[model samples]
Target: MTDQTAPTDPAEVTAHLDARLDDDARAWFAESRDRIGDDPAAVRVLFPAVSRRVGRGPLAPGGDGDDPFVWHRDDAGRALLLAAVDPGARPGELRDCYTHGDARERRGVLRSLEVVEVDDEVTAELVDDALRTNDVRLVAAALGPAGVAVLDDDGFAQAVLKAVFVDLDLERIAGIPDRVTPELSRMMADFVHERVAAGRAVPASVWTVIDRHPPADRLAAIEAERDHEDPHRAAAAAAALDARP
Candidate 1:
């Protein structure tokens, strides 16, 4: 996502999104939204055409903070806005949207899972499906608040590790600080060792996970980085050590 400041208000963001659309796109969005109730397959038709109608630029910008739609492209964000207000967007229909979508459409569906009506099993399935992909965008979207709500602890940890594997920043994984486990700590520690053994720089996110769950043995490893050349890594290590009780 680009570095533009995100508009935190949902209503404001929606207004901004609508403002960006030209007359034809706005009319199409309204008509498609109306079609959701009368036509069962409306989303299937409308979802893919979003980019052509809405444009592919970043909808707002910056990463998801208070505003989840911030990171989405205009089309994806527009799709999400449609899904948000549509009462017909049930789990089965949403699942079909994901199943039939291209990566961008799938991302809109995945991020919408948290707000839409979906059972735990379907949520896990969608999240796992996205996690299994090599697409960093899909992987990142999968680990959103919906993933955190539905994934088991083990599954969540593995997803976080997957984000690290795909070079996504740890901050992008929603609620990760509250979700870390000893297993995740160990997994990240092992990753750090492997990178060091291979003469490679560890992914900066590896420290975020490890530092949050600082086991005694892992503290030494984290402490060792306190003097590392990268200021970010050094600060992370020092913060972890300083937090020791």
Candidate 2:
């Protein structure tokens, strides 16, 4: 919608989206025809349009309610993010877009990884590269949507740990349940210990990772946190008690 050379076929671009979209999303897209456009295949055009039309507050279908994780939802945003991908674009192009692009562009590429063919080493390296950055937005995008499912065990684990390190809202991360592991709990437990010992405030979301049947010590640590002054931390501790091993 924003670009002149928009894709010639919206049908083709949206063909793979059936499973990814729901009834509400379909209706939204239908009404969004003027913004989404009748012709569309490339992500370059769709991305800007979504940004312009969606206005980045809440996600579509749900309009991003009060949930902090809403950034990863909106079907329009998802479709637009995928538009940056040419499908035929090579790894080199994808790499350039990521390495040279601004934050919005980088996010588009990260979101497109699900549909793009990133079999080559360069593209595959992008995931790790983004994870290593302290840029919280990049980290969030890298771990959003298909990322959690696609990243290797260690990569995904690192992403989660990094989110905590950067003080990112864990809800922004998709597939947190599947990605959680005992080793991650240990890492988080260690982090919580260090932070608490230093008189630094620990994010309550850390308990989200630790709540998944963590070891006894970790469970005890979270349970003790139930008395924390911050309602978020106290709430996390309370919830973890029921879910803990």
Candidate 3:
């Protein structure tokens, strides 16, 4: 049997994290300090979160309370100083610490806050409006794949259809047009078709929109294409078809 030794120094374990800080991260840390005042506990929480994400622990051995590398300070001074010095620290991570942390922490950092709740209907409405304007960025941001999945699962076909229509800029419902719109339509259709071919069901809501908006021939063509190679999509398409009359 081989002899096993316990891990020795924590410092040795994390020796690689001692890199210098870049200019932007340093500037942001200074700004954060000015914004949050000199609260040690607040700084401790904020810095540790950033350090954790950046692969640095909060403390260095034999360091004083003024030690910039110590992760558990209650004031912003050390944290800001450490961040300013450590070039590898990400400004985005620090920003996220201010934004995504608990309410109290965020309030402490930002000083003012507003809470807005956009429900399904409102979100759907916003998505629809965004799509109609061909606002790809807004549409994608508002209804990411996860949001799309949620809308599909919840049977929000009209919403999905509107989103797709707007995103693809489909002017005609049934016939394949001459412009790039048809290509986008075909691509989306093909995507659904593959899903159906794979033995997956399209969300019922998506089916509802397809049924109401598109011409029968176009719909049938899309259905026929469902026999393509994706099993998961195939199943979804079958479910979507079943959801229709």
Q: For candidate 3, which ten residues in a row score worst on lDDT?
A: 1-10
TM-score of every model? 0.78, 0.60, 0.27
RMSD of each: 5.6, 8.7, 17.9
Across 1-245, the per-residue lDDT of candidate 3 in tens digits comes to 00011111223222312332345545554465554444423444545344323323223333343221122211122223323322233233334444454422332122111011223443344334433444433343333322233343223334344555443322212221222233344444554565566565454334333433455555686566447466655556566676665
TM-score of 3: 0.27
Count of backbone clashes, every candidate in sequence? 0, 5, 30
Error of 1 at 68 (Å): 12
Question: Which residue runs of candidate 3 sit more than 4 Å off their true CA positions?
Answer: 1-95, 98-188, 208-212, 215-217, 223-238
Residue range 1-245, candidate 1, lDDT tens digits = 22243333445556757766888888877777777756656677777787787777666543453343345555345445545445544666778878888988877767666445567888888888999998887787777676677888888888888887778877657776778888888888777655553445655666678878766676566567777887767765565445434
Better of 1 and 2 by TM-score: 1
How much lDDT does each candidate structure score?
0.67, 0.57, 0.37
Show the colliding residue pairs in model 1: none
Error of 1 at 122 (Å): 1.8
Candidate 2, superposed: residue stretches over 4 Å from native: 1-86, 115-117, 120-123, 218-245
**Strongest candidate by TM-score:** 1
Best by lDDT: 1
